[model samples]
Target: MGEKFPEIQGGGSLILAWQVRNKKVLVIGGGEVAAGRILNLLNADAKVVLISPRDGLNSEVAHRIERKQVEYYDRKFEPSDLDDPAITMVLTAIDEPDASTQIWKLCKEKRIAANIADVPPECDFYFGSVHRDGPLQIMVSTNGNGPKMANIVRRRIAANLPPNIGDAIAKVGALRRKLRVVAPGTEEGPKRMQWMSKVCLKWSLEDLCEMEEQDMDELLQSYAPDQIPSLSQVRLGEEPGTWQFDGSFGWACVV
Candidate 1:
């Protein structure tokens, strides 16, 4: 008998954050799809150029055009638009299939990444569900297969996260900055990072959010005395064997 192998699933796309701030982005439609893409680009601080026939624009898109938030070209897309050296990416949501195909081909020839709405095979990327909390942003994708499912998953994950998670992250960042100054050495970065990871693992999100600088300094003294000069001889008044760490059972302390 011949050997058999398990079937593999569809190829997954790599998720990344594109640095598009202040870069030129081209959108080739002015309907709801184009409006949504424009808003997302604007949120990222990208300079957008929207091109579509004047009669084809939706009311919302027209309103933005009237306000001059975006550079609106009241005409159909032309190949010359792709020739702009400043254009970093292109997005097409035109109803005409031929126009969409032409835009995709032109983008490929120009080595510019592009997304064609409702056409996964023609797109270089897919629009995914995004959830943002301060500096923390989460993106969920279904490989251009199921957008509704991706949105549902994104909402569920967002709902389960603690409201103070962003605050906790900010506190940790401040602690890291302080540690860098107080503990200047070659291995300071990795050592402090490891200590911080351990602290995060052991402490609840609420505790992290509420912890003060003095409390963090004490924690550094207890867990990483060698890293900081001021914490070398500082002790938490606990015996050597009072606290124990078990690989399988986690951390425990004697009462």
Candidate 2:
């Protein structure tokens, strides 16, 4: 029999962690959907400007306007709204079908990315269900196929995750910074990474999260003899668990 290649699967959208910090985004509605978009944008530290009629404003959107959280005009969206070259993204969430389509068209003409709520086909991108804990974030997307289902999946994933994985990450970051300074210079980069990798693997998630600032200080101070120490050595009488620490990393091991 002749050999054959496996069948190919179709491609999906390229999910990205786009940074919109300090950039301007235009939102062309004042309804609840637009309010949610505004919250998400503000969370990203984007400069948001909203356009909607004064009467169309939902309570949440109006509260934002009252607090001056965003710059908005009390009027409907117009063609001139896209005149600003600084606008990076546009979102519309109004009941007017013709107006929403017009906004999407104008955005396409201006080469500005857009998302029209409930109209996935017209959207340049989409909002995913995000579960965030401090510096850790998990996003669930259905590629515009299902929104509610995405939320359900996200909720389930969030429920199953460790309670404070974010804290563990923060602890790692703290150690990395102190370790870098203690062992600085270009030659120390490899040593630094190898040592940190061992630290991440050997120290369980709960143990890392339990580490405090003083523990870090003592850990740094105990960095004698190749700068590797067991948890029991550092803690004095505490159990070291099952992790074996050889204090050696990288290649070239002779048997």
Candidate 3:
């Protein structure tokens, strides 16, 4: 019914490179492409270092670096450009294979992660165009094969998410905490999630402002699991029908 995509790599690749909340990330080369990557890293709260050989740097980027929000180096690439011991990763967009190769070798010797633009084989990681929200980020990547397609997919997904999604998520968080308190011992996690799903489904169909308290209470109460008769007890006096248990971590069902 829907198109399937390849499994994503680096899902939990310890995205935090050092103390990323306030740490250093060095971006070599300057252009619109480098600007985009640096922006995303900055959003993750990484302190950025951008070095450009010439004057092609974006004005906004230069301004931020000048203001000390980011650091900029206006010089040609040198062997020492890769000598930032504090740098966690180096993203090179110099548009040259020999330079990228040399840089990769240097990074390897230094034990630093490096990404070469448009060169997956030489890159330790590939940059993905991403859109982020609080505690949630959507990354679209084509594994270094057509970032244009990735951008298209990202925009398509972005369109489906509206501005109110954040507020709705906050509301859900509040409801989840309330549920944990209200239904502590009576429900399992899966069942609780299902109950929340049903509530959201119903809420989607009605005007929340007009929702009645009695109706909401009735819906919540209905989510409580009804006690079922124990199978072992049912055949106590009979042949004691073969009670086979499918162990489910304290949730066994006798069949």
Candidate 4:
């Protein structure tokens, strides 16, 4: 038998309490490894800049840089590379460990957070495989030690996601204002969350609309600030349907 695989590793317990949209992220690499990290940053809408001298790299990467999808510098990184005011984080996968270490040191001295692909001790952060649905982003990590495993888990989880998830999120977001209007008190927060979760689990537009109307009716009896809403103890009801989605994400139910 082999070593039992860990359920998590490296930076698994980490959670992003803040959003990273439109932030600047720098990468110093030009190979397939760098491509994976770069693609994730792009998906997160970060302003990504890649520094590498390699020409005729992956065709799509070359095309994207040329099209200004990302900025590319056909040169090696320098000590002064940490100059971008907008750059809050950096990731490096350069072949030279010493060079990566030095770059990480420079980033730290300049107060920019950095992560090195294979140097976990030097990394202030770790990369993870991510799947997103509208405003919901799921990131899987085995720290930096097992990105492949993380990716495998990510794909499994993604396969279970219904195609309508994004649309369902959009519909739910549209209903929030109506929810707030009906449940006009701090006491309704938990009940409202429960209701939203119910609507999301069903993933039905008609059911969500009906839930919205029901919420409106429930809130018709406006309560004062100290008044306890009837739904204060309300629990999300039973799921209405069995999803046709894959079962690999069974673990996510507990999550």
Candidate 5:
């Protein structure tokens, strides 16, 4: 029998966490697709502007419009809508293919990314199913191929994560800040990163959550007493000052 090779899939996209806060997002049409995207933008604190006939809006979206939570323009979309400099991204969910295509073309000319519902070719980006735990967020995507599968994976991953994972991360972040202040030297960057990696490998989630500041200080003294300055040596009232990255992959502290 001949050996068989598994088939490889293509068209994967680079996913990123966009800082859409205070940015203007435009949506065309008033159906379920538009409603979902609008809600997501609102959650991110993005200023959303919806242009539609206002007759066929989803019930929840209509309720939001009634409450004036979203800026709604009850009219067909016009090319002039893209002229607004505040508009960063556009989403089109109109039933008419011609209208969606026109909006997408205009967005291209305006250098704005656009997403057209049920039309992958017309989209500059695709929405992913996201799971969030405080500052921790996980996004799963199938390159606009299988959204339901992405949602399933996201739910599974969210369920598997420790409930106190966010707290653990926060504790580690605090420890890192203290390390930077007490151990500001050329070699401190790599040493700190290596120490953090060891900490993650050695400590459990519960251990991290229960770690106190005093314990962290004690641990630092025990681990690298020679590298870190004594607590009494650090000026209590003075700021730690800014850290600048040297071209040689080291950090220089500028007071």
Candidate 6:
């Protein structure tokens, strides 16, 4: 007899950060929703080509056009617009459902990614509420279920994050680069990964946030050739038994 397996639950969307910098994306409509979409695209460095009658544009989008920030065509979306093989994506925010659907179908035919505003079933992607700091972006997605809920969760997370968290990331990134130079190449790959994991598990977020150039120099000393220092030596005077990791923010704490 064939072995039985437990029933599988529903599927999930694969969340990812797309690289759209300098890529041409077609935008339809110029209302409030489209205005928001345009700004999001611009933030990603996407070259936006907006198609809507001049009067359809909101004050913000209109100003953007005048400032030459967006490539504008004061006309309705035409199927021919998709012909610009350079337009790798299209987003529609017009009130016309039929028009939006047609745009989606055209994108499908052309094998281009598309996001049809307010129409989940037809969208190739959904925008999430994003929390941003210098070189840091955290996106919360509800998979088109509840955008407002995503925003609430994002806000809560932003409020709870330790101060100077982004600064910590930047400093750690510099340490990582230094380590790569010191260790150099795949010869130290396994040891390097192990050391990095230990660092995260042992160092509290506040400790990392407070990391200085001198602290980093001392930390690297622990990774000297043929030696991986124990917590007692590398963690200063802190005991390993008192360290804990809080999963809520995925940071270390001293309990």
Clashing pairs in 2: none
Q: Each prediction's TM-score against the native?
A: 0.74, 0.81, 0.61, 0.67, 0.72, 0.77
RMSD of 1: 6.4
lDDT of 3 by residue, 1-255 (tens): 699988976633333223466778888878777877777777879988888865877776676676777787788567787676888888887777898899889989999888888888888777776767664477777877788998999999988875555444444455556666667876377777765654454343222223343433433434454211122222242222332222222211110
- Superposed model 6: Cα runs more than 4 Å off: 1-8, 212-221, 226-250, 253-255
The C-alpha lDDT values of all candidates are 0.78, 0.81, 0.64, 0.67, 0.76, 0.80
Q: Output the worst ten-in-a-row residue range by lDDT, candidate 1.
A: 246-255
The best candidate by lDDT is: 2
Instruction: Please provide, for model 6 over 145-199, each residue's C-alpha lDDT reduced to its tens digit, 9 standing for 90 to 100.
Output: 9999999999999999876878767776777887898899898988877677666
Tens digits of lDDT, candidate 5, 120-175: 99999999998877567789998888899999999999998788877877887888
Ranking by TM-score: 2, 6, 1, 5, 4, 3
The true-versus-predicted C-alpha distance at residue 220 of model 6, in Å, is 3.8
Top TM-score prediction, candidate number: 2
lDDT per residue for candidate 2 within 1-255, as digits (tens), equals 699998976645778888999999999899899999999898888999999999999999999999999998999888999999999999999999988999899999999999999998899888999998877777898988998999999999999988878888888789888987887888888777776776676666777788887677666663333354555556663333422467443222110
- Residue 200's lDDT within candidate 2 is 70
TM-score of 1: 0.74
> Looking at model 3, which ten-residue stretch has the lowest summed lDDT?
246-255
lDDT for residue 153 in candidate 4, whole number 0-100: 99
Q: List the residue pairs that clash in candidate 1.
A: none
Scanning candidate 5 in windows of ten residues, the lowest lDDT window is: 246-255
lDDT of 2 at 122: 94
Evaluated against the true structure, the overall lDDT of model 5 is 0.76
